[model samples]
Target: MKSLRLYGKQDLRYEEADNPVIENTDDVIVKVKAVGICGSDISRYKKLGPYVEGMVFGHEFAGEVTEVGSGVEGIRPGDRVAACPTFYCGECESCKKGELSRCEKLTVIGARHPGAYAEYVKLPAENILPLPDNVDYDTAAMVEPSSVVAHGFYRTSIKPGAEVAIMGCGSIGLLAVQWAKIFGAKKVYAIDIDDAKLEVAKEVGADVLINSMEKPAHEQIMDHTNGSGVDLAVESAGSPITSAQVFALPKKGGEVVFMGIPYADINIERFYFEKIVRSELTVLGSWNAISSPFPGKEWTSSVHYMSTGQINVKPMISHRLQLSEGPETFDNLINRKGSYVKVLFYPELD
Candidate 1:
């Protein structure tokens, strides 16, 4: 099997590796059909130090089941499925509480375990979700990241007719904009430094777009909300700068959700104090989804959303290449060249 492996800072190479086999009774081996590169993956490639070298690199994907372990039931060979990237031990306290994202034994596929960047991937049968008959492999590959945006919205308790301000227009931010609209937010303002991304934001139904680099993002958001600020602000840019912007854009009593991962040293004091002084702002951080919480509903609903044409992800896929082009794709993603939105790799392609 061929897989893309990280060697060091700005180093990625396509190499041959041993094909994965079922390791547990609950494990399943999937023949990869499609996989998407993520912002975190690019961050790792830039020497962020979270991803270890020589590890397979990809997490969001969908494929066909080639084999299933003995303990796997309700799923079998030939079933098309999307994978949940997070691996969790079902016996942990957080897992018991339906918080798999916070499980003590949580391990992300691309980050901790061998990931889906290869021709074959081994996952726990529990992590595989069936794809709807109408969904294609590319759209199904989006389910993992879409689920992350869904989890963030779930944490915010956003209601219809509420106003929203989203910072950043990257994959997660753009997806957040769509989810906010679908969830019935009355006015969703998308803020970003890139005009190209802002254009995509409009296509995804953002009510307003602000080039934060061109104007004051906070003031623009306030002006859009009738000088009251938005009811909910989601920070998806993953920067200390945007993190601060979230506090400035939410109304005194509004809610702010941090969907982006900031550096450990980023300061939150000003935002924390603002939350206390102004309208009682609820600051929430959402992680991955707990697939067990809804029993059989998690993957089904996400797939149905795609299958039914409710969520348009095709427009989000900007680049597709063979697995061997992994190095070039990594470079483009890190340098922010081209019009790349989401990059997919076909392992079987030569």
Candidate 2:
């Protein structure tokens, strides 16, 4: 099988590898159909990795089941599925409380375990979410990322008529714009450095678009909110600058959700730190979505939205590359030389 394996920091190779087989009784071997490149994947490629050398690394993927282990039930061979990347020990207290993301024993695919950056990948059947026939592989692969946005919204306390400012226009940020509308946000501000991404944000549902590079994102958001800042501020850009902006873009006593993972030390100035203390703002940090009641409500909701055409992912996908183009594709995304969003990699050539 052909796979993209991590060699080291700034090194990813498209090479040959042995096909994965079912190792555990509940394991399922999937012939990977499509996989989406995530921001974390980019970080790993750039040497910001705890990634293992020679390990396959893609968590957002969908495929057809080719083999199923004996202990697995309900799911059979040939089932179209999108599997959750985060797996938890069902016996943990957190898992018992339906907080699968907080399970004491958590193993994430593409990080702690083998991932889907190949022709085939193996995972426990419990992680699989059976996809409807109407959902294509490209969209199915998107379920993982879309679920992240869904989970972010679930953690916030935004009311139906609340105003929202999503501080980024990346894939997750753009998705957050739509989720804000779906959740009945009356006004949404999509903030980014790129106008192209802001345009997409508007097409999705942003009532206001601000290029943070051209002017102050917080100033624009505050202006729209009549000097009171947005009711809800979601930080999805994961940069120090954006993180600082989100802290100052929420109304006093408003809610702020930190959905982005910062790669560097984020220094909050004394003014902003004092503001957080004085304003009584609720700050939340949301990690990967969980599998509550099995397979996660976020994943299920994303599937429902996608299947019903309520949340369309067609426009977000800007590039599709063959598996062999892994090296160049990573470079293109890293350099930001192309108009790209949600790049998908197809392992099998039709």
Clashes of each: 2, 0
- lDDT (Cα atoms) of all candidates against the true structure: 0.83, 0.85
Candidate 1, residues 232-276: lDDT per residue as tens digits?
A: 899899988778767888888788888888654576667445654
Clashes of 2: 0
Candidate 1 TM-score, C-alpha based: 0.93
Candidates' RMSD to native: 2.1, 1.7
User: Model 2 over residues 1-350: C-alpha lDDT tens digits?
Assistant: 99888777768888887888777899999999999998888987875754577888788999999999989999988999998888788898988898887889877787778788899998887788899888889989989888888888998888899999899888899889888988889999999998888888888888988988887887777777788888889999988877886878888998899888878888888767775888789998887888577667899998888788767777888888898988888887788778888899899962
Give the per-residue Cα lDDT of candidate 2 at 72.
96
